[model samples]
Target: MSAGTQRMRAAVWYGAKDVRIAEMDIPAAGRGEVLIEVAFSGICGSDLHEYADGPHAIPVAEPHPASGARAPLVLGHEFCGTVVELGPSVTGLTRGDRVAVEPNYRCGRCPRCRAGEYNICRHFGFAGLMGNGGMAEYAAVPAYMAHRLPENVSLEQAALFEPASVALHALRRAGTTPGTVMVVGLGPVGLLTVRLAAEREVPRIVAVDVSPARLHRASALGATDLIDARLGEGVGERIRELTGGEGVDVAFEVVGSESTLRTCLDATRRGGRVVLVGLAQEMSLDSFALVNNEQSIIASVGYRDTYPELIRLVAERGLDLTPLVTSTIALDTLVPDGFEALLDGPGDQIKILVDLAARSDRLGSPEASAGTRRVRPQPGGGEPETSE
Candidate 1:
């Protein structure tokens, strides 16, 4: 390695509230890898859990069993970038291809991975959680992890595929398609679910949220009806009222709080499906209700093979993420002081984009490269693309 390949800048977390925006090595792409110039990275709610609380059930600094990345590590899983170089054994990918990464880097040899349930492999680990994800200027990922975007997708829109895939994965788990579904909690995941349901032509979407800001955001994102859980009124009753007193075909528990969980149970119809996707504070379900309702409860993990479709839904059909993205900041804002703002900022913000193009002049964005892609104005509560 040359001295020129010494280091680059990254925001690393040593421990709780100990993340430092310091310089680290700009990694070289090894065999079967590709070095990507990260264009945009979204700060996840999961990252907040690690920042505000303890080590997110993942202990202090160590190399991820999957990616072999050790701590103090860079923290960001949701990001989009372009392939600048490919390592030996990497094929069919080259420079300047805009792509979104699948953050789950599991050992393909594991039982679950071999069986096509790679999300739960024995060596299962996430990009930001277990290893160095896309927070840095450049990330060397497996060549296979790169899913190229269509000519229509922007880098910032592509960055959203990571979380959007999660929602799609959950909706698939719940078998929710073209039906009246109830999504509890209008955070990033919940809001995405509402939009996905809308795009999929789901008839009625009842969005439930404690925050009035989130309720308004949900309504803006294609929710047919909104219920303010903080109104201190019975949320389940409102959900039932919205659903014609029959409850919904499927219920998505996006908020893992105790009260939200209860509302999830109360809002679903008999023999309905309940998809538990969010991490819970406390998980205890009543045995009596479980037997009586006979609800098919499904717990979905990250995702499996949904990136291409997720991107297509946004790029081709023009999914609306603008309402979700309440703020956008440059790369310098992602460091020292920006970290706090990312954590403690407004609840109305569904998504916050880190513009890598503004920071790295040499490494340009996917949008800036060709100028062929175009985003049109959205319809009622639909998406509108970014422009100069």
Candidate 2:
């Protein structure tokens, strides 16, 4: 059914430790953009960071150059939705199509964009981070940023495209293929990394985490071994034991803590790569060890050109990542049941999906349904307008 209203319920981030479920005017499909009715959105570590100790990526003091949106912005980046309306000049997509948003908007004039490394675009900004995010009933996104979801992929599974792409890109950036690998921190990214590692033909995957639940999930995802971080400081020694004292071929540090980075470096053999996927402010590393071992520390940022590959993996490679999802809640329950629950670090919850279409009696307010206005498509000679 077509979306008949213009108002949407969004989880807006006002400040640190503050996210309110508020009703706002639905954004229209601008030139070369598509109006999407969000189906499922996954809460990310970045979102949690914004909630806990933020103003990190979310523009608070000033409006983002690309989005022109400031704080009180909608917050969610990992999401999949159905195309409800198409803006001018959009091609290869139609209304009712299921899609996963890449979310990042880049300045094509940048050197990085010209080099096909738009992930690091100098003026880079994300949908939910700077502008209209997916934690809402609807979002408007650039057509170029949307990837068509495969027939076999569910919206729930598609919501993982962003994180899975990050995992894949990190592995690709580290240039490690089939080998014994170690993934430190079995959170959503780490768990997904384990699965992607298996898909890449990595023979052995050692997963380390403090949560038994997350470690169990890693094992279920084909991790050859699991380590409980609480077990002590001998994690590297244990990994060496598992790899017969040679250590893993490559280690991915997903936790971004100094201790975890140390563990990853110690567990890796000479000349092996340590891929840092997580973001942390400070880390103290042993420079001598890194230099002497000829180990390269590769820092991975957001993904670039990974959506198509991820979609193909889900559709054809028999990759079953549905186990990563722990809960599915409606928009109203997002604060208590979604964000707060995740912040509490419930050991069992890996990924939580917010189903926008789910009805909630608690979502009743005069303003809740207030911002509805129909937008007429721009008239032209059937030509798509060009917009940056």
Candidate 3:
């Protein structure tokens, strides 16, 4: 590498439970792409899935068609950063601009992309998992995948745009109307659903979760009723009770479990819609109520084009996402303080951000101008796990 060129550090995923911090040349912005210096990268459920039970969304043996890259992937999808460079033919963005990444890369010729439902494009691929990602000090991404962040949205909170947009898309998929709504499971997506639903002025919003800390956060985010899933059999009853026995107008199942799906069905009135936002492989359901009661089951994936509006919501509508981030760590400490802490489970952590510039920022050093640097995993940090 030339002395003028800088080497970047990244959290590279070799396989499930195997992520390493290695040094690499800073990526160059390709045609119709931009090079981003990542500010904050969030450890998403999908990242956790890769760490816990992965090679699921991430490509392993072969390269993905859309991303055209395979294993030893740089793993991170939800993140925000500054545009450090722009490539040929790219427009509407300049260097030094702050932005959040949508991360969804689609084949434009696909049916879904042509129909404006690109989230479900036949060749759908994610940047972080399928290709180069923001876990590193820098990443070069297609311009379409980048959305400018508003001035009011902090770089830290900008990391939340992707997840919050997922919640917004779930609401859109559910065709959420102004009425009673219940969001089951207070994970990041569920909590954001509650917050967005409140912003949309849903008359009654209910949040359900087993975590008291999450429930408290939900209440603070504007959920009118809180149901503890620990209450077991009585959970659905309490939801129905809060809705005056007729049940909710719309029920969102953010926890994609058999019981949570059942709770969604039982808590919605006849002919109401039930939206499934959580990532669950298989779920069992009662056919009688599903068919007889005429409940509509809607499944939501990542997101469509919800970023611009979400940015506007944050900038103009007073949407507060500050509470979502419970912890922040440096890139070198991602495994111990970021991923492992989240994996240790049932803790008070809602969202953890890996500040790519944390160490460099503190030292007043130009991260990209620095030469190659490598950071190996800690003793217990690299042991592979068998779950997702």
Give the alpha-carbon lDDT of every model.
0.76, 0.84, 0.84
**Candidate 1 structure quality by residue, lDDT tens digits, 68-187:** 766556788898899888899888887889888888887889789899999889988887778887877788888878998888888878888888888989988876373678888777
Task: Report the error of model 3 at residue 85, Å.
Answer: 1.4
Write down the worst ten-residue block by lDDT for model 3. 364-373
Q: Higher-TM-score candidate among 1 and 2?
A: 2
Name the better of 1 and 3 by lDDT. Answer: 3
> lDDT tens digits, residues 205-291, model 2?
899999988888899898988899886679999989988888888899998889999999999999898999988999999999899
| Model 2 worst lDDT run, 10 consecutive residues | 368-377
- Residue pairs clashing in model 2 are 89-384
**Candidate 3 at 125: error in angstroms?**
1.5
lDDT of 3 by residue, 1-388 (tens): 2366587878888766667677666888889999998888888888988887787888888889998998877988988899989899999999889998999998899888999989999989889989978898898889998888778877877899889988999899877374899999898999999999998988899898899999999999999998889988788888888878989988888887989998888889998999988778888888987899998998898898898898888889878887888988887667666777788856799888888887733322333222212444344646333221
Clashing pairs in 3: 52-387, 53-387, 53-388
